[model samples]
Target: MYTLILVLGICAAALFLAGFARGLRNAVIEYRRGKPEPTEVPDYNYVGMAAISVVISATVIALVGVAPMWIYAGPLMVLGTAAGIGVAFFVERPSA
Candidate 1:
Protein backbone atom coordinates (compact mmCIF):
# COMPACT_ATOMS: atom_id res chain seq x y z
CA MET A 1 0.00 0.00 0.00
CA TYR A 2 2.71 2.45 0.94
CA THR A 3 4.73 1.66 -2.13
CA LEU A 4 1.71 2.08 -4.38
CA ILE A 5 0.90 5.43 -2.86
CA LEU A 6 4.48 6.61 -3.11
CA VAL A 7 4.73 5.59 -6.73
CA LEU A 8 1.49 7.30 -7.60
CA GLY A 9 2.55 10.46 -5.83
CA ILE A 10 5.85 10.58 -7.61
CA CYS A 11 4.21 9.94 -10.97
CA ALA A 12 1.71 12.69 -10.38
CA ALA A 13 4.38 15.14 -9.37
CA ALA A 14 6.48 14.28 -12.39
CA LEU A 15 3.56 14.71 -14.73
CA PHE A 16 2.68 18.06 -13.22
CA LEU A 17 6.23 19.32 -13.39
CA ALA A 18 6.66 18.26 -16.95
CA GLY A 19 3.41 19.84 -18.03
CA PHE A 20 4.36 23.05 -16.26
CA ALA A 21 7.72 23.11 -18.00
CA ARG A 22 6.06 22.67 -21.37
CA GLY A 23 3.48 25.31 -20.65
CA LEU A 24 6.14 27.73 -19.48
CA ARG A 25 8.23 27.06 -22.55
CA ASN A 26 5.25 27.65 -24.81
CA ALA A 27 4.49 30.89 -23.02
CA VAL A 28 8.02 32.08 -23.52
CA ILE A 29 7.90 31.17 -27.18
CA GLU A 30 4.65 33.03 -27.58
CA TYR A 31 6.01 36.01 -25.75
CA ARG A 32 9.06 36.07 -27.94
CA ARG A 33 6.88 35.74 -31.00
CA GLY A 34 5.00 38.89 -30.06
CA LYS A 35 8.13 40.88 -29.50
CA PRO A 36 9.78 42.91 -32.27
CA GLU A 37 13.18 41.57 -31.23
CA PRO A 38 12.90 38.00 -29.97
CA THR A 39 16.54 38.08 -28.82
CA GLU A 40 15.62 40.60 -26.14
CA VAL A 41 13.71 37.91 -24.23
CA PRO A 42 15.87 35.31 -22.54
CA ASP A 43 15.43 31.74 -23.61
CA TYR A 44 13.96 29.14 -21.29
CA ASN A 45 15.61 25.73 -21.05
CA TYR A 46 12.82 23.31 -20.17
CA VAL A 47 14.89 20.13 -20.34
CA GLY A 48 17.41 21.31 -17.77
CA MET A 49 14.66 22.53 -15.50
CA ALA A 50 12.78 19.24 -15.79
CA ALA A 51 15.89 17.22 -15.03
CA ILE A 52 16.61 19.32 -11.99
CA SER A 53 13.06 18.89 -10.78
CA VAL A 54 13.28 15.11 -11.12
CA VAL A 55 16.55 14.91 -9.21
CA ILE A 56 15.51 17.27 -6.48
CA SER A 57 12.16 15.53 -6.04
CA ALA A 58 13.78 12.14 -5.66
CA THR A 59 16.41 13.52 -3.31
CA VAL A 60 13.76 15.07 -1.12
CA ILE A 61 11.85 11.83 -0.90
CA ALA A 62 14.97 9.91 0.02
CA LEU A 63 16.04 12.53 2.56
CA VAL A 64 12.60 12.42 4.15
CA GLY A 65 12.97 8.64 4.64
CA VAL A 66 9.79 7.93 2.76
CA ALA A 67 11.57 5.16 0.89
CA PRO A 68 15.06 3.93 0.22
CA MET A 69 16.85 5.94 -2.43
CA TRP A 70 17.48 2.87 -4.53
CA ILE A 71 13.86 1.77 -4.49
CA TYR A 72 12.52 4.54 -6.71
CA ALA A 73 14.96 7.34 -7.43
CA GLY A 74 16.99 6.04 -10.33
CA PRO A 75 14.30 4.25 -12.25
CA LEU A 76 11.67 6.88 -11.66
CA MET A 77 13.95 9.69 -12.75
CA VAL A 78 14.40 8.08 -16.13
CA LEU A 79 10.90 6.68 -16.55
CA GLY A 80 9.10 9.62 -15.08
CA THR A 81 10.96 12.20 -17.10
CA ALA A 82 10.44 10.25 -20.30
CA ALA A 83 6.78 9.56 -19.69
CA GLY A 84 6.10 13.08 -18.50
CA ILE A 85 7.82 14.69 -21.44
CA GLY A 86 6.05 12.37 -23.83
CA VAL A 87 2.68 13.22 -22.40
CA ALA A 88 3.44 16.92 -22.38
CA PHE A 89 4.47 16.79 -26.01
CA PHE A 90 1.13 15.30 -26.99
CA VAL A 91 -0.97 17.82 -25.12
CA GLU A 92 -2.11 20.60 -27.42
CA ARG A 93 -1.26 24.12 -26.52
CA PRO A 94 -4.20 26.50 -26.12
CA SER A 95 -5.06 28.56 -29.17
CA ALA A 96 -3.46 31.96 -28.93
Candidate 2:
Protein backbone atom coordinates (compact mmCIF):
# COMPACT_ATOMS: atom_id res chain seq x y z
CA MET A 1 0.00 0.00 0.00
CA TYR A 2 2.80 2.42 0.87
CA THR A 3 4.65 1.57 -2.35
CA LEU A 4 1.48 2.10 -4.36
CA ILE A 5 0.87 5.49 -2.80
CA LEU A 6 4.50 6.49 -3.41
CA VAL A 7 4.39 5.43 -7.03
CA LEU A 8 1.11 7.29 -7.57
CA GLY A 9 2.48 10.45 -5.95
CA ILE A 10 5.57 10.33 -8.10
CA CYS A 11 3.47 9.88 -11.22
CA ALA A 12 1.21 12.78 -10.26
CA ALA A 13 4.20 15.03 -9.59
CA ALA A 14 5.82 14.06 -12.89
CA LEU A 15 2.64 14.74 -14.81
CA PHE A 16 2.14 18.11 -13.11
CA LEU A 17 5.75 19.16 -13.81
CA ALA A 18 5.53 18.03 -17.45
CA GLY A 19 2.35 20.02 -17.96
CA PHE A 20 3.87 23.09 -16.28
CA ALA A 21 7.01 22.83 -18.45
CA ARG A 22 4.91 22.46 -21.59
CA GLY A 23 2.93 25.58 -20.69
CA LEU A 24 6.11 27.58 -20.22
CA ARG A 25 7.50 26.25 -23.51
CA ASN A 26 4.30 27.19 -25.33
CA ALA A 27 4.32 30.66 -23.76
CA VAL A 28 7.88 31.21 -24.99
CA ILE A 29 6.96 30.07 -28.50
CA GLU A 30 3.89 32.29 -28.55
CA TYR A 31 5.87 35.29 -27.28
CA ARG A 32 8.50 34.78 -30.00
CA ARG A 33 5.80 34.49 -32.68
CA GLY A 34 4.11 37.63 -31.39
CA LYS A 35 7.24 39.80 -31.56
CA PRO A 36 6.50 41.28 -34.98
CA GLU A 37 2.99 42.41 -34.03
CA PRO A 38 2.19 45.65 -32.29
CA THR A 39 1.10 45.14 -28.71
CA GLU A 40 -1.84 47.06 -27.29
CA VAL A 41 -1.18 49.06 -24.12
CA PRO A 42 -3.57 48.57 -21.22
CA ASP A 43 -5.45 51.79 -20.78
CA TYR A 44 -6.52 52.49 -17.24
CA ASN A 45 -10.02 53.81 -16.78
CA TYR A 46 -10.74 56.15 -13.89
CA VAL A 47 -11.71 53.24 -11.69
CA GLY A 48 -8.54 51.34 -12.60
CA MET A 49 -6.41 54.38 -12.03
CA ALA A 50 -8.18 55.06 -8.76
CA ALA A 51 -7.50 51.52 -7.58
CA ILE A 52 -3.81 51.73 -8.54
CA SER A 53 -3.46 55.17 -7.04
CA VAL A 54 -5.18 54.13 -3.87
CA VAL A 55 -2.74 51.25 -3.47
CA ILE A 56 0.18 53.55 -4.10
CA SER A 57 -1.14 56.16 -1.71
CA ALA A 58 -1.77 53.52 0.92
CA THR A 59 1.82 52.28 0.58
CA VAL A 60 3.16 55.79 0.91
CA ILE A 61 0.93 56.41 3.88
CA ALA A 62 2.10 53.19 5.45
CA LEU A 63 5.65 54.41 5.21
CA VAL A 64 4.54 57.42 7.23
CA GLY A 65 2.73 55.20 9.83
CA VAL A 66 -0.64 56.81 9.08
CA ALA A 67 -2.15 53.83 7.21
CA PRO A 68 -4.43 51.10 8.52
CA MET A 69 -4.83 47.57 7.17
CA TRP A 70 -8.05 48.46 5.36
CA ILE A 71 -6.28 51.33 3.62
CA TYR A 72 -4.14 48.84 1.73
CA ALA A 73 -6.61 45.95 1.74
CA GLY A 74 -9.43 47.71 -0.07
CA PRO A 75 -7.24 49.09 -2.82
CA LEU A 76 -5.39 45.80 -3.24
CA MET A 77 -8.68 43.98 -3.59
CA VAL A 78 -9.84 46.52 -6.13
CA LEU A 79 -6.70 46.09 -8.19
CA GLY A 80 -6.85 42.31 -7.85
CA THR A 81 -10.43 42.26 -9.09
CA ALA A 82 -9.60 44.59 -11.94
CA ALA A 83 -6.59 42.50 -12.92
CA GLY A 84 -8.71 39.35 -12.98
CA ILE A 85 -11.25 40.93 -15.32
CA GLY A 86 -8.93 43.06 -17.47
CA VAL A 87 -5.77 40.97 -17.91
CA ALA A 88 -6.78 40.05 -21.44
CA PHE A 89 -6.59 43.70 -22.42
CA PHE A 90 -2.91 43.75 -21.48
CA VAL A 91 -1.62 40.33 -22.53
CA GLU A 92 -0.75 39.28 -26.08
CA ARG A 93 -3.02 36.71 -27.70
CA PRO A 94 -1.25 33.86 -29.47
CA SER A 95 -1.86 33.71 -33.20
CA ALA A 96 -3.86 30.75 -34.42
Candidate 3:
Protein backbone atom coordinates (compact mmCIF):
# COMPACT_ATOMS: atom_id res chain seq x y z
CA MET A 1 0.00 0.00 0.00
CA TYR A 2 2.78 2.43 0.88
CA THR A 3 4.73 1.62 -2.26
CA LEU A 4 1.61 2.11 -4.38
CA ILE A 5 0.99 5.50 -2.85
CA LEU A 6 4.60 6.48 -3.41
CA VAL A 7 4.46 5.48 -7.06
CA LEU A 8 1.19 7.30 -7.63
CA GLY A 9 2.57 10.44 -6.00
CA ILE A 10 5.70 10.29 -8.13
CA CYS A 11 3.69 9.87 -11.30
CA ALA A 12 1.39 12.73 -10.43
CA ALA A 13 4.31 14.98 -9.61
CA ALA A 14 5.99 14.21 -12.92
CA LEU A 15 2.80 14.91 -14.87
CA PHE A 16 2.29 18.20 -13.03
CA LEU A 17 5.86 19.31 -13.72
CA ALA A 18 5.58 18.51 -17.40
CA GLY A 19 2.28 20.36 -17.74
CA PHE A 20 3.54 23.35 -15.78
CA ALA A 21 6.65 23.63 -17.92
CA ARG A 22 4.61 23.45 -21.08
CA GLY A 23 2.13 26.06 -19.89
CA LEU A 24 4.89 28.38 -18.79
CA ARG A 25 6.63 28.06 -22.12
CA ASN A 26 3.41 28.82 -23.92
CA ALA A 27 2.70 31.81 -21.70
CA VAL A 28 6.14 33.22 -22.38
CA ILE A 29 5.68 32.79 -26.09
CA GLU A 30 2.33 34.51 -25.98
CA TYR A 31 3.72 37.36 -23.90
CA ARG A 32 6.56 37.83 -26.39
CA ARG A 33 3.96 38.03 -29.12
CA GLY A 34 2.35 41.02 -27.38
CA LYS A 35 -0.89 39.51 -26.25
CA PRO A 36 -3.02 41.62 -23.93
CA GLU A 37 -2.27 41.17 -20.26
CA PRO A 38 -4.81 39.77 -17.84
CA THR A 39 -7.13 42.42 -16.36
CA GLU A 40 -6.95 41.05 -12.83
CA VAL A 41 -4.69 38.83 -10.76
CA PRO A 42 -6.08 35.56 -9.43
CA ASP A 43 -6.68 34.97 -5.74
CA TYR A 44 -4.55 32.17 -4.27
CA ASN A 45 -7.02 30.51 -1.95
CA TYR A 46 -6.46 27.08 -3.36
CA VAL A 47 -2.71 27.47 -3.24
CA GLY A 48 -2.89 28.51 0.38
CA MET A 49 -5.06 25.52 1.20
CA ALA A 50 -2.67 23.23 -0.60
CA ALA A 51 0.27 24.60 1.38
CA ILE A 52 -1.64 24.16 4.61
CA SER A 53 -2.52 20.59 3.72
CA VAL A 54 1.13 19.70 3.15
CA VAL A 55 2.19 21.33 6.37
CA ILE A 56 -0.47 19.47 8.29
CA SER A 57 0.49 16.18 6.67
CA ALA A 58 4.15 16.75 7.46
CA THR A 59 3.33 17.54 11.04
CA VAL A 60 1.34 14.33 11.28
CA ILE A 61 4.20 12.22 9.92
CA ALA A 62 6.64 13.87 12.28
CA LEU A 63 4.40 13.28 15.26
CA VAL A 64 3.49 9.71 14.31
CA GLY A 65 7.01 8.48 13.45
CA VAL A 66 6.79 6.80 10.04
CA ALA A 67 8.81 3.77 11.13
CA PRO A 68 5.35 2.27 10.80
CA MET A 69 4.92 3.25 7.16
CA TRP A 70 1.68 1.34 6.72
CA ILE A 71 0.00 3.10 9.57
CA TYR A 72 1.22 6.58 8.66
CA ALA A 73 1.05 6.34 4.89
CA GLY A 74 -2.73 6.34 4.46
CA PRO A 75 -3.50 9.73 5.93
CA LEU A 76 -0.39 11.29 4.47
CA MET A 77 -1.19 10.07 0.98
CA VAL A 78 -4.76 11.29 1.23
CA LEU A 79 -3.59 14.71 2.31
CA GLY A 80 -0.94 14.83 -0.39
CA THR A 81 -3.45 13.91 -3.06
CA ALA A 82 -5.79 16.57 -1.75
CA ALA A 83 -2.98 19.09 -1.96
CA GLY A 84 -2.28 18.15 -5.54
CA ILE A 85 -5.94 18.52 -6.47
CA GLY A 86 -6.01 21.88 -4.75
CA VAL A 87 -3.07 23.01 -6.82
CA ALA A 88 -4.75 21.84 -9.99
CA PHE A 89 -7.82 23.84 -9.08
CA PHE A 90 -5.66 26.84 -8.27
CA VAL A 91 -4.10 26.76 -11.70
CA GLU A 92 -7.43 26.31 -13.44
CA ARG A 93 -9.25 29.08 -11.59
CA PRO A 94 -10.29 32.18 -13.47
CA SER A 95 -8.53 35.45 -12.70
CA ALA A 96 -10.67 37.74 -10.56
Which candidate number would show the highest TM-score if scored against the true structure? 3
Q: Local distance difference test, per candidate?
A: 0.67, 0.57, 0.65
TM-score of each predicted structure versus truth? 0.39, 0.35, 0.43
Count clashing residue pairs per candidate.
0, 0, 0
Task: Judging by lDDT against the true structure, name the best candidate.
Answer: 1
Could you give the candidate ranking by TM-score, starting with the highest? 3, 1, 2
| Candidate 3 residue lDDT tens string, 1-96 | 668767767776776676576667766677678857677766666988899988976776686665665475665566566557646644653322
Candidate 3 at 14: error in angstroms?
A: 2.0
Q: Which stretches of candidate 1 lie over 4 Å from their true place?
A: 35-90, 94-96
Per-residue C-alpha lDDT of model 2 across residues 1-96, encoded as one tens digit per residue: 446545655655555556555557767887877756556767756888889978876776665565454454544444444444344333434545
Which residue pairs collide, candidate 3?
Answer: none
Query: What's the lDDT for candidate 2?
Result: 0.57
For model 1, what is the error of residue 21's alpha carbon versus the real structure, in angstroms, after optimal superposition?
A: 0.6
2 against 3, candidate with superior lDDT: 3
